[model samples]
Target chain A: MPERGLLIVLSGPSGVGKGTVRKAIFESPDNDFEYSVSMTTRQKRPGEVEGVDYYYRTREEFEALIAEGKMLEYAEYVGNYYGTPLDYVNQTLDEGKDVFLEIEVQGAKKVKEQVPDGVFIFLTPPDLTELKSRIVGRGTDQLDVIEKRMEIAKKEIEMMTLYDYAVVNDSVPLAVEKIKQIIKSEHLRVDRVIDSYLKMLKEL
Target chain B: MPERGLLIVLSGPSGVGKGTVRKAIFESPDNDFEYSVSMTTRQKRPGEVEGVDYYYRTREEFEALIAEGKMLEYAEYVGNYYGTPLDYVNQTLDEGKDVFLEIEVQGAKKVKEQVPDGVFIFLTPPDLTELKSRIVGRGTDQLDVIEKRMEIAKKEIEMMTLYDYAVVNDSVPLAVEKIKQIIKSEHLRVDRVIDSYLKMLKEL
Candidate 1:
């Protein structure tokens, strides 16, 4: 039988270094997992190609897909739609390719509702103080905006109970190692590997 | 806050290298996990310690624990009572140490019922032929006994669906590495870690 791939959902509070960890995991040869390209209504940034970073879509197109229930989970932020494409993820998994979805708290929840077996990983800062420092260091948001983000982070942390595991992003290398370990361990799940062997044994 | 250790259940067919994998995991200094010493009525073999390999118990004591609902799960096999001690497993978990229970198929299901959050791992042989070879290679069992063990292995493989993860023990090192990964990934579960952080943030 062909090996199966795992659907892993990576989420965290803002400024927990999820992006950096993800990059490290991808860069390491240890991770042959595929990344799920998201569908978004946001305009492509500089040097971002269609279907590479995201499947950039018009609002109407995004809405049409939503109405058709084609999207696994989607949300509107700043008047733009951002969500996962069910077909892409399912296809990758069917090909025995582990797929990683980097999304926010709400998106992760929605994906879980749709795919309960999907591995949910929450990245955390070492401590609250470190989280605040990371947010401040970003220097992109005003004090009030950062405060609001911190508030949101607190709310996201409360939802950690819903996830399958948590990794503290104390160091990017360590966090990436943890993420890789989760993916490796998930593949060992018995339900995915045993039935076929059992059937073969029965035939014998 | 100190990190909490996970409760891991390792179950698989006999001669599938479950013991070997467990040994490797325990031998690793980086693994920092504890094995749950089971309680049983079986006579201790040579070199076996009462509290280390197992808590040797009389049939009456085993029955008493069962009647008192202290045993997580108990069963009679060849006139011996074998079961997991609830207090020991709980105490180890509470101490922030991950507990590994190397159990049979039946005991694994019972443990899962008692601790739904516990991670269940099922080790499997690469194939039936290899399974038979391994059992025979042990040089301890008679032909009839080996045959009976294979029959039991077949039955256990059918119940694979009850497990959380299945790992094929084709290679000892590979299997151990996969298990190590699972333990690491489980630590990253979002709901468990993030929610606690979020709760602490709210209180702050």
Candidate 2:
């Protein structure tokens, strides 16, 4: 039987480019992981395809999944719910295909509770100064609002201690390369591959 | 001060091509690690250099170092003493230059006792059947001797569980690539890198 696939969780504080790095990983022709499409109550944007961009759901539908614990982890923002579908993630992994989750820090924390074995990668800005600049570069918030955002970012950065790998997002390509290295290395970990060797030993 | 560099221990069963793979790594133009030159009482070959190759030593001197607990790990083979020097490995690591030790499985186990944090990699033959064939193909051992070698190889393969990563030596370049990934990934592991991130967070 094929070995079970890794559950790769990519997350970071706001504006750390988690989405961009995740996109680069998918755009690479050689990437084999199945991106876990999230279910959301938010309106689908133009050209978005169902089951591709997201599994759009109504308020009641999302709440029902939560009630049934079908959502692996969910959080509401602006009166809309977003979460990972537990069944799809499990099915993909059972098929020996890795599942990649790109989510916010809060959602990542919740995912950790249920899937503690998942490879949690916390992507960070090069430093807090850079992170602040990225936030300010948005050019969309007031001084007080930016300070509030920085405060929230600080709290999320502190949560990095809970992660298994912390990658500096110094550059998109470099970050993607490091993450790929991490995934490949994780596959070779003794605990993951020893059982196959043990079975081979028995045959020998 | 810079973080201490990793002590990379690469070992596997006899005939698994550990030496060939280790040579490939060092031969690579971008390889940055300092190879830990082992001290040996065996006569140096015609073209061998003193420090570049083995640190040729007399049997008496080798025994004195061992008695003083100055050898990191050593073993006597074919009436010749061979071992890694403890001082060189420690001093190189303290200087933040990674030290690579390519040794036999028995030597690897002893090094593990002294440096438990070292990244131990086990290189394996594709399978025991293939391993047996490699032994038989050597064309030098008698049938009974071949069987005895196979027995020793089996025992060494069993020691793979003590390693952190195991790469099957199906091909040299692929195994080398996997080992490189393992090293880069090791550098990124949370336990290895969290302190800098914590200090950065404190400053923020």
Candidate 3:
């Protein structure tokens, strides 16, 4: 039997470096990961390529897809609609290529409801202190915004229980290596082995 | 909160390189695996160390341990009693070290009943052809014995579903590496994370 691809849903609290770790893994020749392009009604940022950065769409088109039940999950943030399209994910899985859904806690939960077999992973900081330091080091938000973000992060960390695995993003290279190992070992799980080999043995 | 160790139960069909891969992993400095010694009535081999290899015991003592429910799993083979002692395993786990139980299918099932949290792994050859070649290469068993072993191997492969992970023994180094990843990832599973942090996080 041909091998099936894995749907890896990666979620984390704010400032856990999910983007950095994911970039390192995908850039390295060792991993073959496809980024799932989300459909968004928000204006495309400068230099963000269509279908690469996101599958940009109008609000009406996005709402149509949602009503058609093609969206795995969707939300309106600051009046912009963002959603995960189900067709592309299913197609990629059928082609035996892994697709990563790098989302927040709420989005991850929604995806899990639709695709329960996907590998749900939560990225974490080394500790709360380090997480605070990382968030401060970014130097992007004011004190009030930072405090609000910290509160959200705490709540999200509590929701780590909703994930299957928790990866600590202490360092980009190390975190990428650990996640790579997880993907490799998950392929060798018993359920897959049984699905791939069970009935064939009887014929042989 | 203190971290807990894992009970790793490794099982495979006869002559499937279970011993070879296990030896390679234990010999490596990369892993900190503790070998669980079995209480056995069989005579120890020439080079086999007493506590390191097997805890040699009289039948009376072994039966007494079994009656006391001290045996995690016990089996009789060729008029010799061999069983895993629960005290030793629990002690090793308390020390926060991974313990390997290299037993066969029947003993593995028994042990699973007692230690339901153990990570049960089934090791396999690349295929039956490779398995047959490996057994024939050893040149130890008669033709009838080899045939019987092959039949048993087939039956054991059918029971691969009983395991959590299935490591194909394509190469000793590769198999060892896969198992290492499994151990590392299992440590990061959400259930363990919850067990280690659920109560402590509330205090913060």
Which candidate has the top score in TM-score?
3
Model 1 global lDDT (CA atoms, 0 to 1): 0.79
Worst lDDT 10-window in candidate 2 chain A: A127-136
State candidate 2's TM-score. 0.86
| Alpha-carbon lDDT, every model | 0.79, 0.87, 0.81
**Candidate 3 residue-wise lDDT, B1-204, digit = tens:** 256789999888877887888889899888887888888999889999889888999999999999999999999999999989999888888888888888888899988887787898999867743454544656776988766756765676677878899998888988898999999988888887575554543443
| lDDT (Cα, 0-100) at A74 in candidate 2 | 88
Ranking by lDDT: 2, 3, 1
lDDT tens digits, residues B1-204, model 1?
Answer: 455668899988766777888988888788878888789899999999989888999888988899899997777889898888888777888788899988887788888888888888888767643564555667877988877866866776766777777777778888888887777667666544554565445553
Decide which is better by lDDT, 2 or 3.
Answer: 2
True contacts kept of each: 0.77, 0.59, 0.61
The DockQ figures for the candidates are 0.45, 0.44, 0.44
- Ranking of candidates on DockQ, top first: 1, 3, 2
The C-alpha stretches of model 1 lying farther than 4 A from their native spots are A1-4, A40-46, A56-64, A75-83, A129-153, A194-204, B1-5, B40-46, B57-67, B76-83, B128-154, B191-204
